[model samples]
Target: MLLKNERISEIVDGKRVIVKKPELLAPAGNLEKLKIAVHYGADAVFIGGQEYSLRANADNFTIEEIREGVEFANQYGAKVYVTANIYAHNENIPGLDDYLRALEDAGVHGIIVADPLIIETARRVAPKLEVHLSTQQSLANWKAVQFWKEEGLERVVLAREVSAEEIRQIKEKVDIEIEAFIHGAMCSAYSGRCVLSNHMTARDSNRGGCCQSCRWDYDLYQLSDDGREIPLFSENDAPFAMSAKDLNLIRAIPAMIELGVDSLKIEGRMKSIHYVATVVSVYRKVIDAYCADPDHFTIREEWVRELDKCANRETASSFFEGFPDYTNHMYGTHSRKTTHEFAGLVLDYDRETGIATIQQRNHFKPGDEVEFFGPEIENFTQVIEKIWDEDGNELDAARHPLQIVKVPVKRPLFPYNMMRKEN
Candidate 1:
């Protein structure tokens, strides 16, 4: 079965035009995150499998789980793609053909790859599965895109360093689908090709062993005339850091749509479920609002605020306008904290008693004020007037993680609804 039609009508230049809305693609690190991504409004989700995936540390999917995830996503009219984007050595090539065939049998919509061997092997052995070139290839020009299109690849995830004008030029010249990162973390290196982790920690970043050595704190030193090293700064100065700010293109949706970008991808496969849900939901609203009525669309402050609650680092519109400057890079050891924390997820609700069953994620006590939100409901805040456990015993707090609790609520809530509290 095909996914839902994403094309919508918009009035452009006094003409009614039908535009293909960009797919809101989200990251699914595991099965739970996959469900959350679809529930919160992702048009599609990309996940890492157990082998040949870039995120070696993530709890990736098994072939069976990939099948189950495909079944779940199809019910919601969404698509699932598997990531086999790791740069391959000879040792990684033996069983890849079988794995590709297995993914094709598991009903995966496509496979994202960066290596020539895997691409050729997929085309030869697993021709049913669509192949998308990963951003690790760093295709920044129209000629590179044309080369890939000639090779029969369906899509090319443009390098993050590609500017808006470059994207426009590529669309003008190339006929392949274009995918770009719309939100999430940024690599300090070009298109995530970095050797800092391999040099510092003996982990090959291109082969799924990145240790994020660039984000670590490092002390700056100066060599003295006596051939001794001296600290560059006093005790009060923070250690130097080279982490790039996270990407936030909440305001760039309209322009990307006009450029005919096929997909807007969120970049964290190992992120938390709350982060996946919040980011996907925010972008979903933005894309829909802009596509529904381009002439009257405006960026909403609440959308930005909702995104701010889930961010762990400061965000920037990196490389979208042009080359980034000093403001795009984080130079000191500073961490960002959000104002809200995920507290619980709704499991079930009883309309007669006006009570909702919740699975506690963080801590929440009776009388605490919290906001509840869902895919189909407007956010509403209400005090936790009463709490009970699964056994119907009253409780003072839902302090334990994943604890099943019942709470009285003023409004009806559905499954997958999330609740958050002030930090």
Candidate 2:
């Protein structure tokens, strides 16, 4: 049950893009999202404990829940890495040690750590633990990577600013694992070492509570002739230059895998379960195909098709695939395309009736064509001609949330298929 497996043959290319399939390391803010990541095709999942990590505001797991989550991830054959990558105050050291002991007891696969003192402490305290340097440590060159390797860090999650070529150089220079971010929201500041969020609010983003004041359109405060403040974007036409675009590396997976990157991370601890399902599924198919046939691999249009199921701004390759157009939108929102309506949730399929039970998410009128996305094989759609409620009474449409309904089918569907349609 490998969510994403890519073994590569060495292709000599300093200029040509030759890559192996990078592991799809998805984020899991909670158990539901973790299930989605594993079901779709995440090789590994990184989650936050109560503290000592970014994304503290996410539906982060408590120690018990984290242990349960790690064991649950193993059932699907995915590795779980708890993020202990905080810039710690001296007082928090004892608390951090407790969390590490808990993770070790839980049998976690690894830990993503940032601070030098923390890494040193982790090596001395949890000798069996594998430490992955967080990008906040800023391993920009081969020397820094070598330094980490000598210090006993097994893997380095490279900074987002590192280019593909630099990644190749690092891979060539060292035996340590190099994991890079492939997709998700981009931080305007370097690899999220910013204090702006915490500066504005008493909540510290470094300790995991980000207010996200960066997203608001703040008016410039300047004195007019009358000493009154005025909006700049309204009159003089200078917009607030704060927000950045979310990273999207879907088109460049083939090349990235060839670079020998051990993991391809998706940055979204604060994202939806729908996003976890849709994006991971798309990458799963392409990575599967690439493994089977690297040279003959093709990016199907269906990948782009199913991608519209969630809301996203215009995508950029980030710094990994290539140089980005700096003015892109990397921040995430609840915006989804209106082209299709999410009709219903798929319940178990009836072997006897050849009908699937669905708890409706939206209305579906009769004779309307629909698309079906499962936990797997999501990009492919199976159309249903007729719709009905649980009573076996035919209905023109289903218009309620969580309304139990039935959809007749010729072929058998699975346990977690989603039913959708064009408006």
Candidate 3:
């Protein structure tokens, strides 16, 4: 990865000053995830509505959910940006206007869009809402940033392919704000402009119907002129040919902030609430640490360990360097290597009784030791002396999904804190 100490000069009274710390952006597929994200310390959350969203498979928010999510985020002093990032067809325009107006009424802080027509429509229909240019447009250079700025974009999510030097240059040239994918899945194709999903699954990748064809294991083959198929590799050699490693810039936060990135986006709207909570919490800490003392900033090993506990694939700094080669690609089986799994979330804590009401997410026995962690408190592990259901029945384990249960905790705990058990 590019670990350069590049700095931009700002003429403040003929003196240079670095920009403010970037916002730690997180993804929220639904209202529950939105709550988890905000509670976990995300400065801003990006969500997709029921229509015109790229992640169609995600449990996108309904119009009412959007209103509720906006309100929920506002309470935390965090911003909510709704996605209207679909590459729309002619027939999608009429409903687009309605959706934009509804989002405006929902009180969203901003709209993330990709298409020029949609951008123009948002400018006309919901002028009060801030318009953010999505990464789907693949903005790589200063000129493209300037063009989007001229076209009236408040911020642009820079193309994933842009290098660190290019990002610095773009910021130096364009007066508009810049957002970059600091952490998340890296598309094998240019910022998700892949045609493979469309060709193989008849689902347009550009339209948000990507089936993740790249992550599938495949065997190499070659066709002869005589129409005979020859195997290039044995079945044992079948590999995750196009699976790219997940993007992680935990160690590069200070460097990226110095480059003037306004927002650092975390991808994966289809991820679980635990994933959103874990990733956002780590990034939030790193950003705060850096902003507090840039000169004395140091990357925390625990922050990296926390991210690894939730990442689905191996982590790498994609294209933030120059061009990534085979190192960026995961060649074997695609899998997550988490040392622990989410056990449950603290629903309510009874301080007088020294017990916490939790909604179980995974199986955990009464004797099993688990760690309790949250946004502000230090993580501590405690043995569960007893696990009782909501009806007050003592249980050997809390196994049911979303099962309300009470577990004894020694230290003071609060709602939204996470519990995790060793895998």
TM-score for each candidate, following the candidate numbering: 0.94, 0.84, 0.92
- Tens digits of per-residue lDDT for model 1, 1-423: 011223445567786553778889999999999999999999999999999889999999999999999999999999999999988999998999899999999999999999988999999999999999999898889999999999999999999999889998888787889999999998877755688888989998998899888788889999999999999988998777777899999999888987788999999998988889899999999998888778778999999999998888888999999888878878774567777899999999999999999999999998899998888889899999898999999999998999999999999899998999888
TM-score, ranked from best to worst: 1, 3, 2
Q: In model 2, where do residues sit more than 4 Å from their true spots?
A: 1-7, 10-21, 218-238, 326-343, 360-368, 375-404
Global lDDT scores for all candidate models: 0.90, 0.75, 0.85
Model 1 lDDT, residue 253, Cα: 89
Clashing pairs in 1: none
What are the root-mean-square deviations of the candidates from the true structure over C-alphas?
Answer: 3.4, 5.0, 3.6
Model 1: ten consecutive residues of lowest lDDT: 1-10
lDDT-wise, the better of 2 and 3 is: 3
Question: What is the lDDT, from 0 to 100, of the residue 92 in candidate 2?
Answer: 78
Better of 1 and 2 by lDDT: 1
lDDT, model 1, position 388: 93
